[model samples]
Target: MQSNQANDQWFQSAAARDIHLDQLKRVERFNGRAAMLGIVIGIITEGLTGAGIAHQIGLGALVDGYAACRTQFLPFCF
Candidate 1:
């Protein structure tokens, strides 16, 4: 009787684990689809705004200058 009870408990635990794994896999699939959708939206928005890759490089330069000023504690930065 004890052996049968132990086997029953083990089977229940295994079934529960399988159900949880299925839910996680479904969630991961949804996340991947959502990420792809976001990338498409970003591309469309960038195209409509006319901010090309060159504009992005100029922005990066400004950010780098700001970082250098902060690190040097320059008076002009204040």
Candidate 2:
């Protein structure tokens, strides 16, 4: 009877551990999605208002393209 009780206790603890892990994974997913949404909003606001989120996306590519054009073709670069 004592061995049966011990088995029951072990099963309970194992089940609790699995539940805790599942909850942790859910929380992490929620936090990641929330953070991504916030960043997207910030980027859109910046794009619409000329705010300092200028460093957010493909601005670097634009700049590099412009520079290459100026050096290779445009005479007005000076």
Candidate 3:
């Protein structure tokens, strides 16, 4: 009975750890996706639209990408 109780506590902690790891991975994937999206938008905006409008999407995408990356950047590296 005591061993079973201890096992339950370990499972709870492991579950919590898994959740944190999953969130970290998700944030990372989004960061990379956002960066690529921003670059593509910038190119299309300049190529088809014009420098001004292209820059608008480009800048917006860049900011979003940075924000996403910042979320996990430090923890990911260190």
Per-model lDDT: 0.79, 0.80, 0.77
Stretches off by above 4 angstroms in model 3 are 1-3, 52-78
lDDT per residue for candidate 1 within 4-72, as digits (tens), equals: 999999999999999999999999999999999977776776799866444444675566568789898
Which numbered prediction scores highest in TM-score against the true structure? 1
The TM-score between candidate 2 and the true structure equals 0.63
On residues 1-78, what C-alpha lDDT tens digit does candidate 3 reach at each position? Answer: 999999999999999999999999999999999999988877887787656552474575666556677887544422
Q: Give the higher-TM-score candidate: 1 or 2.
A: 1
Give residue 64's error in model 2 in angstroms.
25
Look at candidate 3 and give me any clashing residue pairs.
Answer: none
RMSD (Å) per prediction: 6.0, 6.8, 13.2
| Clash total of candidate 3 | 0
Q: After superposition, how far is residue 20 of candidate 2 from its true place, in Å?
A: 0.9
TM-score of each: 0.64, 0.63, 0.50
Question: Considering only N, C-alpha and C atoms within 3 Å, which residue pairs clash in candidate 1?
Answer: none
The TM-score that candidate 1 achieves is 0.64
Give the candidates in order of TM-score, highest first: 1, 2, 3
